[model samples]
Target: MDDMTVRGRWIRVVATSLCGVLLLVGTLFGADDDFPFGPFRMYATGPDPNGDAKDSRVEGTDITGRTVPITEGNSGIRRAEIEGQEAAYVATPSRLSEVAAAYAEHSPGAAPLQSVRLVVRWVGIRHARPTGTYRDEVIARWTRP
Candidate 1:
């Protein structure tokens, strides 16, 4: 194998140093939007052992008055997408109409939605273990007008 030239060695050193600096800056100032170089805080920290675990889901009341889950298969929208913009949904519950519309477009034969809501299920925990209890909270809701 041929040896790396002095110029090539200098280029590699500069590139490595630049990468290190970028990582440092990203770690200090970047958010989740800046991945790869930035630290992903989502999994970086552990939750409090005794704190409640949250699970969010979307649900809709159909024309038949049956409440059903609005999953990715039915709505083309994932739970994570909803969780990421949860604050906006809570601020303006009317945005849930978009999810209802998405479900209608994706599942043409399904019952039409009468209302959509964002629900959060909080599971009780103790000593980092489940307590076999949970509560559902409606964070936002939109009824067809």
Candidate 2:
């Protein structure tokens, strides 16, 4: 192959330098929104060794009073989606009705959900080890009237 041109070498140097600067700035100040250039906090940090670990899930009470798990297969809504918007759901519990609606649309033949709730199970941990104990808390709920 022929030797690289002067302008091509300059372009490569400038691009590499710019990328390094962006990465430095992102590491120091960027959040998840600046991925690829910014650090992903989830991977950058470790969980508290002696703290409770949160396990979030959505559950529904059918019209027949039976508890049902609301999974992506059943509701077409992923667990991550729920966790990602957890604050919004907690702020407005009524929004859980949308999950119930999604379940209804996906499972037409199944019993209808009478209520939907976001539940979090906090498992106790000590020295990075699970203690085989957990407490469930309801963070949000929506009931059909």
Candidate 3:
């Protein structure tokens, strides 16, 4: 090969090698920023039944027969109400740190507590009289580690 041809090929190889090196370096150390990972997921499973429960009897033939009672108690009626007002949001690491800082500023003693998972549960509202006002209660579970 001519001298110029050999020099040109050598330069091309060096340029490619330098580009690869720069790419690797950028991937490793370019951005030291935190990104949002997850807000997680939650699901509710169980009964949300309907019908009267009073005179309804759960006979073995009830599932196959047509002579069903319209009673109040045995109707197997149920419902679920979920409140997501206080759900957590996923944020970047820096944002999380800011949140921690805010928590620390407001409640110094509670800052040490580690929040892991949040559990949502159903609250049942029952009425005393037929026209009585309903009551609300929250059923919750928490995970600590």
Candidate 4:
């Protein structure tokens, strides 16, 4: 081939390789924070290896003052969604009230919820053995207006 043809082929190869690398790097770092191009990082990282394990669930108090555990099926929302929004809830508690409204609406014939709370019951492990210990933390709560 001519000198110009060889140079053009080499440039095309270099550009293609550069674009591939950029795409891979973007995918590795961008997750659960952006649009359709990246991965869903909701459960990408497991519980901290050094920290205690946690079992998370959402609960709410009804108008009758009885505590009710919200479920994915009943509310069309899941624990993972709750966990995902925990940070935003902590920063702005009013978001919980919006979720509570949805929870109340989803449960037919049940007394509406007065308040919603995200409670986590966690326990530490030692050497991969159960310590027979746990504690509850009320992460966030929002009451209906």
Candidate 5:
């Protein structure tokens, strides 16, 4: 084969290899995916049992056995006691407050408000599930009290 033809084929091969490497790297570490890459920010993950309370509290242990506090801003803390055959989950007021703060910081366009309602809808199960399997899902809504 001619020297020019040989050189052209080598360039094509190199270009193809570079493209493949780039595509692989993009697929592995691209930031355009819909999933969030940061920490899990879920507060609660179950059913809402409280009818409504202006101030409420939920107490429980985190995945690390540390006390988890769930508190309300406007005297809206309601009690939700989840009972199982062998155990019960109680959410505390301070834990609820932490959830609210995290939500407020993470939510887009959340403004300083007079009051906030934090609702814990789920409690994490410890031994019954895997680590980080239990998620306490919470919802925070700002209102004029």
Candidate 6:
């Protein structure tokens, strides 16, 4: 083999081995409750048949007293959008009022939002079928001042 060909093959082998080591280290030591490296716990572990499925959504009451579901497209405020701002939101949930105001401005057809609330609904899933009835829990609320 030519000298250049041998050197190129060694470089490829070293690069592949280095990547494998990185992935192993990251998976072993770089995991958190909400963040995980490759080989997610969800995929590694089996789903609990009796576990409850919970969904969270931000909703609001309009001036007309109608209920409106706040969405990312409408309110431009998604929990997922706050990637690095979870702590900030936990500290001052009233910050959501700013989102409510923006949503009211964009949704002219709908009456202005009178207040906003975070609703968490959960239902038990047994063998992939919804077993228990639905339950709603309002954890947070913010009204326009």
Which candidate's lDDT is highest? 2
Which stretches of candidate 1 lie above 4 Å from their native place?
Answer: none
lDDT of 3: 0.32
Model 3 ranges with Cα > 4 A deviation = 1-4, 32-145
How many residue pairs clash (N, CA or C atoms closer than 3 angstroms) in each of the candidate models, in the order given? 0, 0, 11, 0, 31, 0
Best by TM-score: 2
Scanning candidate 6 in windows of ten residues, the lowest lDDT window is: 30-39
For each candidate in turn, the TM-score is 0.93, 0.97, 0.20, 0.69, 0.21, 0.77
RMSD of 5: 15.8
Q: Candidate 3, 13: how far from true, in Å?
A: 0.4
Model 5: per-residue Cα lDDT over 40-91, one tens digit each: 2232243234322122334333334444343333223334421121021223
Lowest summed lDDT across 10 adjacent residues in model 1 is found at 30-39
3 or 4, which is superior by lDDT? 4
Model 6 residue 111 lDDT score: 81
Model 6, residue pairs in steric clash:
none
Cα lDDT of model 1 by residue, 1-145, tens digit: 8699999999999999999999999999987888877889987789999999999999999999999899999999988899999999999999999999999999999999999999999999999999999999999999999
Using alpha carbons, what is the TM-score of model 2?
0.97
lDDT at position 96, candidate 4: 80
- Kindly list the per-residue Cα lDDT of model 2 for residues 5-98, writing each as its tens digit: 9999999999999999999999999998898899999999999999999999999999999999999999999999999999999999999999
| Clashing pairs for predicted structure model 2, backbone only | none
lDDT of 4 at 12: 92
Q: After superposition, how far is residue 125 of candidate 1 from its true place, in Å?
A: 0.5
1-145 per-residue lDDT for model 4 (tens digits): 5566878999999999987776677677766554344556655555555577788888889999999888887688877888878888888877888777777678889898899888888887776656779898988888888
Model 3, 1-145: lDDT tens digits are 5566878999999999987776576555544331112211222233334311121111111222322221223222211111222222122222223322333355444323232211222233234223233332222222222
Query: In terms of TM-score, which candidate is stronger, 3 or 6?
Result: 6
